[model samples]
Target: MILSWRKKRAARRAAKKQNLEVTSNMELTIPSHFRCPISLELMKDPVTLSTGITYDRDSIEKWIEAGNSICPVTNQVLRSFEPVPNHTLRMMIQDWCVEKRSYGIERIPTPRIPISSYEVSEILSGIQTAKDQQDAERCREMVLKIKELAKDSERNKRCISANGTGGVLAAAFKTFSKVPFEQNVALLEEILSALITISPLDGEAKSYLGSDSSLHCMVWFLKNGNLSGRRNSVLALIEIVSSDQQKIDELLEIGGAIEALVKLMKEPISPSTTKASLLLMYHIVSNPPSSANSKVIARLTEMELVKILFEMLVDCEKSICEKALGVLDEVCSYDEGMEKAYGNALTVPVLVKKLLRISDLATQFSVSILWKLCKNDKSEGGDVLVEALQLGAFQKLLLLLQVGSTDGTKEKTTELMKLMNVYRDRAECTDSLDFKNLKRSY
Candidate 1:
């Protein structure tokens, strides 16, 4: 009887152990921290909202999509709607899921590591070291890698740009620019491409790029590099000069800056490149260092910039045309520019055609250019007045006076009209188009 009782007790213990195992297997509970607050289920992808509350990405996104502006738990207004990924929590949840694979749980795949400022700095440091050692291949590789990272995402670009990448780029440019043109031309082009990619370069970054060596190097690129390189160089130069007037003046002092810019403008490189070149020229002529100087005018005209302006006036896009006209207006404000404009066969007719056709800005610039061309005693000669009358400048001026125009443009138009009237009879086409309705607002 004792043996029978021992057998029964042993059997009962074995059955009890089996039952305990079944119970444990049936109750697969998730940790509270692993569960999303909104769903009360295991979080597959946890993200932290701006209110410091964490939730599964799908659940929170659904909740926000339902027009719920406040946090579900705290009922607090979100500081910003941008949700940050809870990387640490995600890792923990992923690990737990892996350990529970026997319970039919799948492992969460590793997330792609987002590019950060740290990564940018590390890559830049490597580039600098490679460059210092004259490791051309290594430097090229690192620069291309940086360009890839910067192009991969806007966040990456912002982080890279915000973390002194400009100075790194400037350093790389200065280093590689010393390389023989045939040896590192492609590498320099890549660097300039990278520079233009992170554009509207900030004040500090602009200051770095605005350095004399950088300006000279970029000018060299503009003059010597290939098509894309020349365009990118122009884009980078725009950012550097756009920083301030001092930088613009400094760039103007560079020997080949204006000549290269004019060449870029005239070339059918790309609309964006041409537009940026025009903008750079506009800033230079409009700002200090005085656009009226004969030497400045001579540089611009010597490169056939005036001819390009007339061509753009008829064929280029509205913004380019406006800027082209603006630069022309500034150029014509000087005696030398006036002569260049008057000499160009297309200049007067194109200026007359754009008078009231494109935009108010175009009209203003057109009138200003004509005004400069016809300035009575201040101008070189009265021949431009007869040329203007023949080209129907008086008609456009009268139309500009009658139409809605800025006060400054109206003043210029009225002055031009009066000047043309003084020489209207000498020109072949002296008949003014109707001026009965002409009225100046200022």
Candidate 2:
């Protein structure tokens, strides 16, 4: 009995010690910026490569061992494998660890240098040789290699990008874009995945990729490619078109281009992709020569894009919702846009819900949209007014007056309220206690 008791006591002590270790690790608050970009942890031995990115030596060395020539952060090719020891950064990290010891952060031990640059160069050369030859096997290898390398660090991204990975991929895309579909489709999918991995091509790469042929190829891919390909293609176009008004015009000019992008907005793609598509549309619709804007707006309406925007308002980030609202505000300024918005059943209710504490900008856009809808004195306006009353928009307006919305929003909301009064006979306007209290409070 005494021996069993002692065994249990010993087990409990060991478990308690393990639990303490976990608790200490959990309580340590390592600042994200202090972490090694690759490992995302406190750097014991931080080393800066030629590309000027500091990574934990172990993580970066392992990355090099895996046959990657490019820096992970910048996606630029590493000129040399040599990573200079960042002594000052190490000391600062050590000091921080020591200073935070009371807060349960353990001191990071000094890190030792692991491998020489010669080994890294050997691995890189082999990978480059494999990539240079148009060997299908080698191209497949390059795809995964580039994808993993791009995932390591931001500095490595700059390195890969600067070192011409995008150009390499773009060159491959040019070659594969022409080949027979059955033969090259899989390889092209791999290339597209790699491109998606290192997306938002830098300015220099974007400049090279903004060709008419590139734009055409992307549109084709969007039309025919698989789900991943389509999403990546849209993101690639966003980078390619960027802020150049001419490129935006060129993108819209491609056949099925506007429709393809609008379709992407409604598709089951990730939120980020959807937001990117929206941003691209915003660029085209938010500012352009009025002639171009009119054409784009017409295309958007024809594609039923307004309904998609309303669907997005149901659950999206504040920033994304704000951008969508901004686009809605611009689109609804047109007669066709207003008709489309008013025609959608969910439009007014979604806008009304968002007005209740969604951001200041969102509220402004909602008010603008409501104002435009209410400005029409016909039955359409009366219908919207009735919906607003049913949705408690009247209470929201009174609250807005009390909370002091922006001059424009307040003015529009007040105008909407007056219009509601004008149309009260057409629709049974609610005069609930909240409405009465809001009016008195205002």
Q: In terms of TM-score, which candidate is strongest? A: 1
lDDT of 2 by residue, 363-439 (tens): 88889988997786368457888878877788888888998877878888888999887656666655332222221
The 10-residue segment of model 2 with minimum total lDDT is 433-442
- Count: clashes, candidate 2: 26
| Residue 278, model 2: Cα distance from true site in angstroms | 2.1
In candidate 1, what are the lDDT values of residues 1-442, reduced to their tens digit? 9999999999999997887677557878889989999999888778899888899877887788788899999999988765788999999999898887766788887654557667888998998898789777888898899888888766577778888777777677777666254577777778778877877666665666676666777788888877887888878877876656677667778787788888887776888888888888888877654533567778778887787778666666898889898898888777677777777767666777687778988888888877776673355557777767876778777866776688888888888888878877777664333334333111
lDDT values, one for every candidate: 0.77, 0.75
TM-score of each predicted structure versus truth: 0.68, 0.66
Clashes of each: 0, 26
Stretches of candidate 2 off by over 4 Å are 1-43, 46-140, 162-192, 289-292, 315-320, 404-407, 424-442
